[model samples]
Target: MLAAAPTNALPRWKGFNVLDFFNPDPKHRRQHTTQEHFRWMADWGFDFVRVPMAYPYYVRFDRSRPIMPHEVYQIDEQQVQHVVDLVEHANRCGLHVCLNLHRAPGFCINAGFEEPYNLWKDPEAMEAFVFHWAYWSKLFRAKTRDQISFDLLNEPCLREDMNDQFSQRSAVPKERYRSLIVKGCETIRASDPGHLVIADGNNIGNEVIDNILDLDVGQSCRGYAPGLVSHYKAPWVFEHPEHLPEVTWPSVENGQVHDKAWLREQFAPWIALVEQGGGVHCGECGAWKETPHHVALAWMDDMFSVLTEHDIGFSLWEFDGTFGILNSERKDVAYEDWYGQKLDRKMLDLLTKFV
Candidate 1:
């Protein structure tokens, strides 16, 4: 069974996204925020920040190699130290940090990347993937268990159209994925026995609870909860015109309850898995620009309630940009725009309950 944190240990919770750290300026490379970001998060009543990192960023990605890139698997010590420094900074600011492998050496489930992992066929790629985790485990062995955690992959989807080794046809049976997860867990535990390992759900946070329960990987499992409520208005997502009078939280009408109950229902299986020795962290969940201001607030209110009720840790999708809490453009919409209006002190106050 997974052990629980002690009572005095920073509540094992609360925080938002730390997106800029990994996706930093190409020139700046790994250089990210110091005290300011942590202090700001602390001030906002957040106790943690999920830092999504790409493996290729730390290692050189050479396009001139053979099958896979030649330098694709090597980890640079200097780059690794930069990440270590960020963790230490986070600790100093009293923030829990989750080192997320957002983009692995060969794959990103996000579709924006050119090559995604197809572990079933590529032996070299699989070795690199496992080796990367092993390397990280060795590097971060010194940090306090609760002070940091590791998210295995951002989203390992089992989609049919991706045409990768992990697709429906050539996919490692669900049992094999469990074994890989165990191997990854064992690798980390061998070095840093106490650090938490968060395993992403399959189908991009849509499935895997069933697999997790059935396979029985010996650790607490967690996953990204997604931003369906907030993404109803995202341009990338197509909504049928026939399905108009779009359904949203806070309701399109006044009295009806927006689909909060259904959203919670979707989490039922994962909640059950958590009940059975696994822990849950809703790694990604947020409202996007498409959601109306009042509706977004209402959605957050409901979402927060459910998360708190279930005692799940969550991180908003981002800090700045489209679905961001802080808009990068610094527009004065916080008080004016409907969406902006919902993102003020009042919303922060509500979020404080969990943080």
Candidate 2:
């Protein structure tokens, strides 16, 4: 059984990240996560939905050129309303909604479009980033914490190429990262004082944030550690995705022993946060389809077991794409047809066991 957090800890929310509007390119934006997806999740004993958004996907901007700093303030009600609609639908289906800026005003984890300014170095970008939180907070002011929350940003890090694995990547100096998070939380409360806010862990969600606990905000972690197991053959993440060695569990490879013990070791920092009055959740986690099915499942089991033992909840990276349980397109699994989509039953069963 999963243990409970301290009295002040955030609710242990278990669900998947819904990619309703995640793409940066307006033309290639994914279809809105269906209403049936929400209902299915509720019926399957899940109670959380994370909507990761690309700012460009919901704003009015020139498609022919990159968005300017001033353009960040251009509010497109028609496009933005889609988020409101999905949040309400998910809430009605008994799921708490966490809205995240996967691709924010001036920074993105992936190499989608060129940002006009650096979020960490430019004052203009920082203000624009906070403005977004303020806008979203006021838009849903009437909704309580039980129905809504805001994840300030997606995995954050400082890298030369941002997307390339070979780039010079480093933590966003903790002092700077802390200030940004504090400002974001403050901005949201200025509009909706009773709202709940969560900040992804620094350094691409791999580590814990000890600085923000006193602010009454939860901290989110990731499950994509030992990238060989989670992101194998992922083009954007690995320089040579095609040459990634075959994954294995209970085996020492890449100078790292990837077994249950290593899984627990990775989670130690987040566990310390809980002891100090903070809540932890795995914000984005899953292996790409190219990974051998059985190896991926084994890694997921150990990771989930450690999270459960530590009293943490998680949101899978996505609901219906390459990393999802539905239509994952992995050749090895014997899929179960669930309402026309190929469902990975083993993955679902594993998730259910931990939940």
Best by lDDT: 2
State the local distance difference test value for candidate 1: 0.62
C-alpha positional error of residue 270 in candidate 1 after TM-score superposition, expressed in Å: 2.5
**Where is model 2 more than 4 Å wrong at Cα?**
1-8, 162-166
Instruction: Give one digit per residue, the lDDT tens place, for model 2 in 131-163.
Output: 899999999999999999899989898978744
TM-score, candidate number 1: 0.78
- Candidate 1 residue spans exceeding 4 A from truth: 1-12, 21-31, 63-67, 160-172, 208-228, 239-247, 250-258, 328-332, 335-346
Q: Which lDDT values do the candidates have, in the order given?
A: 0.62, 0.85
Q: Pairs clashing in candidate 1?
A: 107-116
Q: Deviation in angstroms for 7 in model 1?
A: 12
How high is the lDDT of residue 3 in model 2?
78
